[model samples]
Target chain A: MNRLFKKYEGKLPLKVINDIKEKLPKKISEAKLKKILEEVVMEYNKMLVQPGESVGLVSAESIGEPGTQMTLNTFHFAGVAEMNITMGLPRIIEILDGKKTIETPMTEIYLKKPYSQGKNIKKLALSIKETKLNEIVSEFMVNIAESKIELRVDEKRMESIGVNYPVIQKCIKASFKELALSKKGDSIILKLSEKEKELNQLFKVKEKIKEVYIQGIKGITQVLPIKKGSEFLIITAGTNLKKVLELDFVDKTRTISNNIFEIASVLGIEAARQAIINEVFKVIQNQGLNVDIRHLMLVADTMCATGTIKGVTRYGVVKEKASVLARASFETPIKHIFNASLIGEVDHLNSVVENVMLNQPVPVGTGLPGLVTKVKREPEWLKNKH
Target chain B: MKNINVKKHMLVPEHSKLTKKEIQELLEEYNLSLNELPKIVSTDPAIERFNVKLGDVIKIIRDSPTAGKSIYYRVVING
Candidate 1:
């Protein structure tokens, strides 16, 4: 555990990030490995556009004078299909990789506004609904109708309509779960195509599989992909952790590590670290340590994370500068034993971490060598002895 | 007086705060004055149907939730 922590607990330099990539084991079967790295890169991109987060944009005052924050309404990702929502990811990666899916299919919806300057305040609040939003729209309409207000369709929109219904085409191209219903005023009645029916059937099967998979892994919440060649699957078993301990006398450590790695590939390293923390707890809990679970939590945390496990104070899991508050959340204590064991240097931990947010630097195998050097000097003295 | 009796609440589009010149321009563009359009309060619930500025004349778009493109617009009153 110390060795594992030692390997990661500092800011990995750019050279190191490259070195890790270079040292990465290569083989034909390791196409999965390359895919994993690509996914990691993708995760980084997702982090970039993470909403409501501060980003380094040129200050408006310096450029075009101050205006209100461009707080436009987010459209429910204009996706009729779950996969085409990949459009954003694809666009991001294309730019990153210097390859473009420029011709990748897109549907356009034209609102009744001129493209000129002014109150573009009417943002497209929704692109489309994933969970039968037509019902919600119907409810809203019902409310308006209840007031005895007459509703009418915008004739001018139909008159000026130039673009083919890109949204409709995209919906049809998607997994075809769209339900066409008759309305009172629509002169153009669109019938659901046969291809659309097949898609809907597929959606039903997908949903059923999800239900079965979720039911199967209720208790043991390790991600287990349904298929060998698939992406990450968070295995949630209804059975107890005590059951996992009973699994055929397999190489328990290796099996756990492999699962952690699998989760990391699909989800990312933070999740992998979580898997490591959770699995360790389950294993030791089965061992039935007389020490508090919170103490074991600190130890497991000191192993899985950069900082040592301090007591869970009213301020919560105090993380060191080398550690992160964002990832501190991974150590979710069971039963809400809010107050518990205290370990590690509190003052030094504070210097490394400020109030909730770490001020100095993340200990991802980089500069702040204090934690890494400590682990390296100690070198798994207690962990490996067993 | 045999014309349709437009309800007072239906005139939610009449809450213009535009300057006399700007309001006059808008009125002329739509071919109307304060007397022609029905009076509506800015607080009227139906005024939310469109986004119009003070003195801006909006043309309330009625849309069918289902089926083909059917949209019509009327002014929303703004204070």
Candidate 2:
């Protein structure tokens, strides 16, 4: 039986063979197994991508057609109130265009082992959230005559977020080297220098002091701990994939950021390719659209083909085309033509667009092959006799 | 402790460096040169542990939702 299986291994994928083995009856005959394996190979071959199929065009239409029906609704309430994610058409555009700065960047961070089981889950979530000075301050008392701005520390709020007085003191000291701070009971008084003691300067220092970064990961503005299945995880508003992945408790393998460039830089281009597929598929699934996963995979592959994420926009994948005319036809026709002529670039008409521009049959589908036939017209004498 | 096995991730597929013989067979099977194949940077975290060099072909075995499983090949290139 083992030898029989070995014989068919080269003909079928290992997963398919393993699946068949698991599902087969113990009492099945060798001949029946052979027949089953043969049939599986036949079915697999029948379902494969055919030659001359315009897959890129098909995938484009499959995803693009559903895009028209998608609502322009930008903000999606992500169960956590006030954390709105960009979704629908605008988001699809943002992702496909490969915009560097996304409208709403976020991350879903999975914790390691026992931490994922709600062991100090709240504390962990709080620690991951960036605590601004304003969030932990109760009131700002400005001493007009003394050139001092006093910040009353909200002790209860600080304790809840696990931030101590010393941490706050350190944060302030690091941020404002010029301002001399003196600890006075629950309030920390900051005294500006005599030269910079104008009312306007005092107010500016007061406003700037409010935004001091106190603790937690820098970019993560807010973190919400929610139970996903049996495990507890965090969904953060702002994304800092590199820093978050470095934390001791974070499950680096599972944690993912919605920012494609971040993923590309942190995890590598392949992961970014997978991210593109998952993100696009998520939007399509949420919108009740049915596009084959292969289509999305093809798009992802194209975007990541050059070992970096490039959008379908003119500056990205379009700019990398081999044919000069294809690049010229996409956008800025005159500019592309001028540059091509200046460089003495040539258009080989290899792609569909260039051939179309020249009023020739596009080299795809039936036009892919060249047919050579000898026209057996009778010789001139024979034709005249007929 | 900071060392995370990248292949263990759900999104990451099984990545293995192909032998010279295997690479030659793959090239012949696809009728493509090394450059015609898709590329992965030599520093890609997924294949970092493999200690792959430039021009080495890496085979990726992915779990596909539509096709159940799919295989992809990428040549390692300098970033």
Candidate 3:
């Protein structure tokens, strides 16, 4: 079986050969196997994309036609009860628009070995979530006469997250150096400086103290430990891929963020390309659409071709076109034309849109190749007669 | 600290730099200039291990759902 597979190794892809090996009958004849392999090669050849095919247009139409049917809404993913992720059309638009700041940035964090098997999973989840002062503070008491603010700490909450008063104090001291801190039974007192003694100032200090960062990885607002298959992984509302991956327990290889820009910055352009394809395809699949993955690949390839992810929007991928007319045709036609004239930019008429605008046979499909026909005899006879 | 290989990730696929001879053969086979090919930034983490410079070609092997596997070539460019 191995020898037979090796014979057709270059002819068929490794995946196809492996698939054949898995599905082939145990008692099949050598001739039948050879015949099957030949047929597969022929089919694969037929599936190859033809030259001069307008794949961009086909992909645009395939995706755009299905996009109209998608619902504009957010849905909570399974196991993540309260977090609402932007899904359907809105998600597709966001990915394609290359919006740097996504509406709902999320990360699916996979853990290593023992931690993934529910060992201190809750503790791990809490440690990854950003804890603010407001979350652990039971009450904020303002004493106007004393020019001080007292914060009653929730000991249970603090213990659950494994944070102590010193940690909170250090965090507050780092953020607010001017304020003086003192400790009471269960409350931490913050005395306002002489310069800031007004009643309103005390109220303002109370509000500011409530938002100080205490512990956990920053930007991760919420975390839910979910049991997927046999392992428990975390699903976070906010994304901090760089910080999350730095943790010792995180399975860095499999952890991924939904924010494309964050992925690009943390991972790279290739990862960003994959993220775009996955995100768009996920939204399309969720909407019950049947568009081919090749279209999504084309979109991803185009977006990442220039070594960076550019959206399909006018300011992104469209702005980088070689043809001036093509850029003008997309949007802001007058402005594009004016800019081109000012710079004395030339329109090469290399693309389909510009040629169509010029009422010529668009340089696509059959029009891509030029004809060199002979007409010497007819031209000579006509010239002699005239 | 144990270094994590970004290339080994499921989404990253396999990326390898093409030799000068291989790149020449590919350019001739496709009838395309080096600049005409798709580009990947030098700073892309997927190719960080390669220690690639500008104008180098990278061959990417990706798993395709339609076809079993697809191969792509991209030239390295500035970030």
Candidate 4:
């Protein structure tokens, strides 16, 4: 019963679950589970707010060797900087083609380190450029040219619009270091590293991406950041920017012609202000919004930028911190049970969760002694009385 | 406590030490907070983390090459 936290190491702490359940005031019903987990999430958010403002994902710092004394005063913004792995092009293709199950589905988390923006924006931007929508289309155009002219952008609209799955996959590719790559001819291969495959089995594939033809590129500005306000619709996938331009009211030259972004623009000013956010929304939807949606979007955008989905935290985004032994023997609280079973203390479970909850140091690896009960130090008010 | 100047709130702890009276008045006369005061010792925990003041001001200074200098405020943690 104590052997569940590991497929790799078999540190199963199922006994700890039993110990925690006893401590829990309520039964394990759906509503109760939801409430407790939501508490866990809300607590996580509160720790992130700084004095001035909650730092947003766009971390941009201009000039110097990075953060020179004078530079801290600049518009120092940071984009979501976490790393996780996606199902690589080949694996995604396999998933798309129905060759694999989402056993340990990949999800990501992200948090910004205090000053990494000064360290690597140029590399991050280069990685971002590699995911450019047009560049993806150019590749498709190239592949199609060698085979058929009918497939170019605007030629079929499908070639230019929708999910841009290939680019999304490439974005995932370019953002993170490939821990594993295996090629066996026409089937290029890839395997996610432990860091990349963190939320293994946490995502659900919602929609099978369908390719759409490009209506032609339009200026991004041509489309007002209005939601569902258009009189016409050309996109069978995203809003039809080409069709919208065809409208007498919208002057065509001012809008961007890429169909996916156009549809994103149609989604609203909030969505259009940053095209990446819109895609993130879709990825979370595809995966299922079991956790906080903002966390999902945060994780997804970080992945879009970094290519892996781990819950974001200050030091870095977590990729794959899977404790397989815990999952298998989850009949009861493994940590508590282990401490009880071995060290004779039922406190380990709460201690682990508490450490994780506070974003403080957590017990690791061989250090996790089977089971335990009770908490160590609850923060005390410095002064006892007035 | 009643005489505590509003501009000096960023300074002084629930800070264990009292600032020399002259520095406190000098800070208030300038209408500038402690953050404007140059950083001296950095060993203080409040200075390093919360940027609170014992005799320090987390003043706002805006210095950017492109936008030029603009005034901003900060909880000067160090000096």
Candidate 5:
């Protein structure tokens, strides 16, 4: 075992080597171990990417080809009303484009310890779901003659959301200091403070009151606690990654938001890179497409290689290309050319795009292998004699 | 200074950058030029924590399901 381990020391990681050591039988002969190690080494060799493979192009084609066949539709979450995930091709485009604000920003929040083991999950979900004052109000009557607005809060809805009238009153008072908020049993009355009582001003205040935040975490519109195996995880419709991770009961290590830019700023570029790969793979898999994960990983790495999330668009990764011609090849060729000339930028013609654009042999595959042959020449006198 | 340990959060692969001598040895082993090798930006978060310079090579060790562990190399270039 030691000899086998030493043979593939640097070739494999220490953890894998230890695992192999543990799995080997104590009575196995040296020859048998040698054969097993050889097979393992061969398998390892097969997994490596070949030199000059043009992985970027391969990855693009692999994803793009399958993308054309994907249906453009949003998938509704199981048993969750009005919570539809932007899936299929549109979702893939959103991810690769690195849009700052996605149509449906969501997160899968895992709880820590007892919370994950199906304890107080409903309460936890209620606490995370965002509740605005407007959502719980059954009626909003604008009394223009009295210069006031009467908001009748839904008692049952408020109870279900676990928010009391006092909390709502406090939030309204803090948000709108200019307006006086008075609670009358289950309803809250809003009127202009002694300063101004114009009809227009009261109308504006009435509109603003409807949008005031009441309780619960902001940006999380809904949360559904679903049981998976022995643990329970919450799926939120809207994502506020920073705020969610701050909760003591949340499993910071496992909780993930689908917003790549948010992840990049909050967790760092590596996490964003991983999130991109996972999200892209998830979208493709949801559509029942079979694509190698390595291709997705390459795309993710390229997008986040510069320590920020950049889309595949001309404004993003394409614009960062070293070769001016390569940049021109991606999109907006005339604009790229015009800008490159103005700056006197040089095109090294090193990459595949520029070479292909110029109709020259691309620097990949067989083109990478070149030969330099020296021509043998006879002296001038010997040539004349011949 | 607070160290942002990226590995603690997710399954980040092990990244070890190769020195000049080791890079030279890798080139000889692979029988390829520096340009032929796969490129990773110098600012890539996986290797940014290390004191790596331009033209350095990085060795990435990832745990794969098919293969127990797969080793890959990338040449570090400026972003």
Candidate 6:
């Protein structure tokens, strides 16, 4: 046991070391222990990637091969009728492209303590759901004669969303300073200021009133509390990660948004890298496909290595390549070549793509090694003696 | 200045800047030059917390399903 511990002292993690120690027989001979340690070390070393292996190509092919077989569809969140997560091939493309705005941005918000244990989860979910003015209003009637627009509030809807009449009135007044707002019972009346009180102005005011922010978190269109592993968590259709994290009831450590770029900007690039890996893994797993997490991690590392999230496209990571020929080989060869030539850029051809483009042996695998020799002449005295 | 703690993040691997002696030992063990190894920018988020400079090497320890744990070395270069 001491021999095993000494052998793997700093090389292996403490958890792995302890696990091996617990699994081995307490009375094992020194030779047997040594043999076991050797086997474990050999297995670990074999799992490591070789020095000159093209990890980028392997990762791309690993993901791309299975990516073609993925379904092009969105998956409905389990037990939540209103929310659907973007999944499959289209979602993969969206993520790899590093799009700023995805078709459907969502977040899974885990709650802390009491909330996760099913304490007023329904009411909490309702409070978290964003309620726009148009969603809570029953109808909007524009009176041409009075040059005013009247919005009838839905009492039940407003009550359910926990928004009061005064709150709606205040929101409308704060948002639209050009219009005068007055609340009477369930209806709110809007009229343009006297100086600009044209008939056409009322229609514009009516349109603006429809988009007024009434209550709840902005950008989160819907929120549903679903039971997951005996704990209830909220899943939101739209994402507002920063705002959501600010809530006192949220488990900030576990709450995450599907949008990687948002996570990068708000959390940091490290978090963004993790988000990318998780998002990709979730998509692949949802489609019943098996992909090694290492490949996804490699891709994520490449995207976030420069302290920012960049896409694999020409405008992103490809554009940042150091070699001129490497960038030209990606897309629009002429443009990249011309731009490089204009600046007198140099191409070292150190990477695989540039060498492959030039029909040269790539500096990977067998081509990584080179032979060199030095010739020395025999001394005249030694030659004469011979 | 960001409030989010990258070190506490679940996905980020543990990172430490290698000393000069350690870097030399690593190079000798791998039979590689500084440029031959993979590179990471000095501003990379994983190593941002460390007081690393250009040409410094950072050691990253990641949890791997197949290997139990894996160690990787990357040289820090200017962005």
Q: List chain A TM-scores, every candidate, in order.
A: 0.18, 0.90, 0.89, 0.19, 0.87, 0.89
Candidate 5: pairs in clash: none
Candidate 4 Cα misplacement greater than 4 A, ranges: A1-230, A236-273, A286-290, A300-386, B1-79
* DockQ of every candidate structure: 0.01, 0.50, 0.61, 0.03, 0.25, 0.28
RMSD of each: 33.1, 4.4, 3.6, 26.6, 4.9, 4.2
lDDT tens digits, residues A1-386, model 1?
22332343232223334544576666434456545545655664565434432221222121112112222222233323222222222222222222212223221111222311212311211111111212112121211112211113233432222212333233323533443423345221223434544545534533332222111112332222121232221222122222232233211222222243333332222333344444434433333422233333233233323211122232333332233333244454432223222333233342222333545663332333443333455557777897
Best-fitting candidate, scored by lDDT: 3
- Cα shift from native, residue A153, model 2 (Å): 0.8
> In model 6 chain A, where is the ten-residue run with the lowest total lDDT?
A265-274
Question: Which one wins on DockQ?
Answer: 3
Question: What is candidate 3's lDDT per residue for B8-70, written digit by digit as tens?
Answer: 666777889999999999999989999999998898888888999988999987887765777
lDDT of 3 by residue, A1-386 (tens): 57888998878887888788999988998889989999999997898778789999999999999999999878977755678999998899899989999999999999999999999999989989999999999999998889988999999999999999999999999999999999999999999899988889888878888889988888999999999999999999899888888889999889999999888877777788888999998888888889998899999989988988898899899998999999998899999999999999998898999999999988788999988987657677778998
Per residue, candidate 4 scores C-alpha lDDT tens digits across A91-156 of 222222222232222211111232122234232212211123333333221111122111122223
Angstrom error of the Cα, residue A30, model 4: value is: 43
lDDT of 2 by residue, A96-126 (tens): 8999999899999999989999999889999
Candidate 2 pairs with clashing backbones: none
lDDT of 4 at B52: 46
Alpha carbon lDDT at A304, candidate 3: 85
Give the per-residue Cα lDDT of candidate 2 at A40: 94
| Winner by TM-score between candidate 4 and candidate 1 | 4
Per residue, candidate 6 scores C-alpha lDDT tens digits across A1-386 of: 58558777666556667688889876888888777777877886787689899888899999999999999988787776767878899999999998989989988999999989999898888898887899998999998888888999899988887878888888988988777888777898987788767877778778878998877888888888889999999988899987887788988678888899878766656567778988999889988999999899889878876667789899888987999888887899999988888999988988988888889999998899878777789889999997
TM-scores, chain B, all models: 0.31, 0.94, 0.94, 0.28, 0.85, 0.93
- Candidate number with the higher TM-score (5 or 6): 6
Each candidate structure's TM-score, on Cα atoms with residue i matched to residue i, is 0.16, 0.90, 0.90, 0.18, 0.80, 0.83
- DockQ of prediction 2: 0.50
Provide the lDDT at A246 for model 1.
26
State fnat for each of the candidate structures: 0.00, 0.42, 0.58, 0.00, 0.18, 0.15
Q: Which runs in model 6 stand beyond 4 Å of their true positions?
A: A1-19, A29-32, A78-82, A357-359, A374-386, B1-62, B69-79
> Candidate 3, what DockQ?
0.61
Off by over 4 Å in 5: A2-7, A13-25, A29-47, A372-386, B1-7, B11-79
